[model samples]
Target chain A: MSKNGFTRRQFVKAGLLTSAGAAVGAGVLKPTGLWAAPAKIKGPVKVGYQAIMSGTLAGYGEFHKMGATMAMEEINKAGGIAGVPLEVEFRDSTLKKPQAIKNARYFVDSWGADFLAGVDSSGQALALAPVMAQLGKPLMVTHAATEKLTEIEVFKKGIKEIFRICTPTYQDGNAAAFVAQGLPAKKWATISPKYEYGYTCWKMFKGTLGKLKPGTEFVAESWAPFGTTDFRPHINTIMDAKPDGLYSVEWAGELITMIKQAKQAGLFKQIKHIMLPVGAAMDVLEGLGSEMPDGVWISGRYFFMFPNDQRNIDWVARFRKRWNHYPAYVSETGYSAMFAYKQAVEAAGSKEAKAVIGALEGMKMGSPAGERVFRKEDHQAMYEVPWGLTASNPKYPFKVMGKQVVIPPVEFFNRPPFEGPGTHPPFKG
Target chain B: MSTKATYAIYLGIIAGLAALGLLGDRFMVYMGMRVMLLAIFALGYNLLLGRTGLLSFGHGALYACGSYSMALVNLHLTQDPLLGILAGVAMAALFSLIVGFFCVRNTEIYFAMLTLAFGMMIFSLIWNLREITGGDDGLVGISRGSVFGLPIVKDGQFYFLVLFFFGLTLWLVHRIRSSAFGLVLAGIRENHQRTSFAGIPVKRYRLAAFVVSGMFAGLAGSLGAMLQYNTDPFSAHWSHSAEPVLVSLIGGLQTFSGPLAGSVVFVVLREIIERYTQNWMLWFGIILLAIIMGLRGGVMGGLEKRLRQRAATRKGGE
Candidate 1:
């Protein structure tokens, strides 16, 4: 609404209402005619998606696009959702927070997107929470693995419209701790990124690992800032500490750099047991190639070769055939999010944001990643992901996960109210 | 154009922008607010580049200082936007004065390099001081509380607040550019040695212009943080510093309103192109290349040149 007491949006909406009313009335008048029933769903449900589309991380955006595009085509081909077509528009959110917010506004206000999806950075995800509330639209986060978006924003702040289709930091933090407790290594040290994501994951890993093993000692820690290309000093710190085990939460290019440097420094040989929370990421594996030493334990939000189910295999084959490249975790999550939206929209029988959100709560759907259920408490999708040791494989160019260990979401995910011993993960720091 | 006509044109633009804030939809208002902030930043920046002929790359440091100071004040002290603005502007002015004291000692490439160095220093400081600055995640959840008891929590209302500041900055910059001090600064740009021989403290004038330019950057930065509801360390990065320099260059380094026109094209054009293509940066780069190469001077400079030639032709015909 403007100062003049009306807006073009309101006027168009009113006109639509009148015409819809007349159509309903005409349908009622023609009981025996062809137009007996009015359409229960709206036409052309618009979804706006955003992701990092430039710079070194630009590949993430391309993979995200492939999955979402494939899902959109598949949905439309199947007579769309509830007899109405699904429209999706992808915008580059970049790495900047302002640009991310601008893209969100562009989606809802300019492009008339009813539901929003795909954010790559935790900063962008957290920032968009307030704006999503203001816009009164549902944002399905696909890539960003921030715990705060669910544990703090949605669960505590009660921002109902926020939902995560992918696993949060628990997959990177607590899940790794669950995997670590099984190993015999008693002393641990880490070389992680020097930001919130790194801090949170390291904290979760150490706390949970200590809780699980009772006598585990965190020997030394090295925090590498963003854009860190060298890891010799950090590796040396870990080597000097002579920890029985090592943990690192670094991801993407930085992780690749750290591993390459660590391999060169013989740091990998020095520590018999090592864990990389995000080491199974496609980019890291692809980047490291043969340089990525075998035997390090790793896990990710979604691994394309996981579950090993027929559905997973078929989806991976299709994705590879279409893209001529392996599906990254973001690709899987992006594809799954589209289907999630479709199921919610069709279940609710409406394209309205509120209706879709209501339908999405506690909804269970089978995806390439196996069965995923959106937790009613925090809207964080709960599922199982496998942690495994890296090993050479002839089937793929890079090392594949061997001796996989699966961690259930309920075992480690921070519960609602996110505080105290029972509800939250052990908080020692 | 005559003074009266110029005044009228400025008034018209202000009125038009105000109308946009009142009548435009949410997105439009938000975009309008962005353009106004850029305009404010560019306007002040042009004072140093166009009026004084000095290029200081460290203005972004001043901007970050202002943004962080204002955000800290709002977060800890008062939610009053005016007080935040004052804190932002004061901090920027003080910081710029200190930086200008050193930077104005040299001219040309040396000064530019000095400013760039300072800018990156601030960026690293902001990045490393994670406890205070929030690291790369930035300071989020900032609210536009109110202006003298009038709530600007809504972006539409906040648009008016930015509009007021934009108008104020424009008027101030215009006054500075046309004043006697402006001419002396222009003299300094044309030839500092000659200006110094004429008994004017050339370095003092340069320092003054630098501080004023920095003050403007601070104002824009403070408002920008409020508008975006956050401030990040990137705001102080050299890449961020390049925005004003690029805007001034593309708009016209020699014209008063050149950077203002450039900012409009810079922001709006990118927004429009982004809607059409995913590879917006490539297309935007191509367009900017054409503008920079084809237009000899900037957009405003080229237009002014054409107008001058046309007037000369009319006189010859008469």
Candidate 2:
């Protein structure tokens, strides 16, 4: 035996043989086998991100990628979740539910992702609830603001894996009604999208506004279909009704078109108090540019200018520098989702689904959208996003929100046992 | 290939799929299921496009008919997957009969446009009929209940069911392709005017082919809905209709196994490209363009030509 308890010849033989064996093993074996170990916190933290990466809505995916990539870089730089390296793979979800499910399955089953994030469409989000439950991975929904995802899937159906970092339809409907109640305009008219989203929001807005301020009338409503490029008829219908206030749930390019057509038709002049629940969306604001009329009440899932904290302000600057554009509401949500995952993973000290979910439930985290708390009941993140009046800012090329109205999320968010009178979407007129 | 060799090849393929179900991971099994479903769809679609030389673009509506009917059955009636699938087939057949009646009168581009119009109409119906069809959100939470006491909710378990259906579709399509009706359809494709002059009802044959093709699309859609446990109006969209066309084009239109080969390449390649890059569409488009441009006859077509040449050289050597 040598000084190390082995003879010199034995040591040399062992070292050379071991080196040869290792070289052979490295070539033959899967890398996953080399790294994988049964532990509470082990292996690289893998996140499978999916978003609309095709068609007209593809821009949203890019914004999501920007925010998520930034978070990933920052987290890795800061030593990652529980000292494990964080990795994210982005897939194009394409607004198709099957494709979304396939992407998710590929992430969790094939790629062995610890967490999932970034769904763009409400339909796709809702469709994923069962699949996510089956996959048994935490899905931190960054966008896809269908209340049904939380209320129906997570709350009623008890699919605990689903969690949304972004605000739901309450921001578009109940919160809009909360802000609108303060206005002198008692009679409200709407030109909304002709779908479940449009209908649900209009119903919620009417129900809440009526409750808040009695004698509030939904005088008239016009609904435009999904791909309505022309809104002249919808504007004309609103003009004929001649209500005191106009509330529209038309979002994205549709909102831009509606606003442009309304402006041309002088419908904005006719209706002095106008409210667009999704008007403050960066796409709509940017698309309309200087053409977007000022003083119109608008709200979004997030407003970059509001939450005027150092964190949010710094984030906006960083995002602008990184992407050369103002952060869309989805960007903030996407960024926040990564932080939420980090916080939960670090707190739990485990990448296991149940542990991370337990860590997430009722957990509070600071974000660019201000302090967000994942609701214990439904896994919906309760966060503050202001409803404000659209105004021009010297800093921006497009219209910005000026007079901000921040509503507490709990007041507008549907409580658990969501079937009751107050908790429901006022589905019955 | 000899009949025995063809049978052996099909058996080998089925065995491979069965092995995949038994041994492959969740994602592989799931993707295998998808490829099988698309293969079924493309096989039936090739009956019209390859066999009869008629291109109908409204097959997606028929596909949607199957999916929605199955989902509706699951939601409202019984949770039996078999019954739901049958309902899908029935609905797809009925709708296709109606659509094919109008479409069979015209040939070529006019037939394609009629099908497109009909497909969009169904799409609009699904989109507008919120209460019944669930509108844009569609019907979610479709239960994959027990089939013969075997739980199929799991991807690996459900894969065998898809494999079984895939085998059935392949066999059925093979039978149809070799039948007298298949010969008549081929003759019509070569010269419908000449076939009509020979006292054959060309329109009836076209309608039969269309309905049969639609039935296959519906079967694929039904199985697809079961696999995913959700159905949406997008299934009825014109874009969805184009998938079978693309698959058929990719596999080899004239060959029997063209769609099967095409489905595998199309699905697997898209998935692989998507895994690597966010610009998967661009990459997939480029790859698809290369395949389409380089191989005029598709992957199977190219394979057949090479195989024939190899066999000729072997005979020359002999």
Q: Distance (Å) between predicted and true CA of B155, model 1?
A: 1.8
List model 1 lDDT by residue over A3-38, tens digit each: 988688898998897788678767766533343456
Report the lDDT of model 2 for residue B67.
Answer: 95
Segments of candidate 2 deviating more than 4 angstroms: A1-40, A424-429
Model 1 error, position B315 (Å): 1.3
Deviation of model 2 at B246, angstroms: 0.7
List, residue by residue over A322-343, the lDDT tens digit for candidate 2.
Answer: 8899999888888889889999
Q: How displaced is residue B312 in candidate 1, in Å? A: 1.2
Against the true two-chain complex, what DockQ does each candidate achieve? 0.57, 0.64
Candidate 2 chain A, run of 10 with poorest lDDT: A30-39
What TM-score would candidate 2 get against the native? Answer: 0.93
Q: Which stretches of candidate 1 lie over 4 Å from their true place?
A: A1-36, A426-429
Docking verdict class for candidate 1? medium
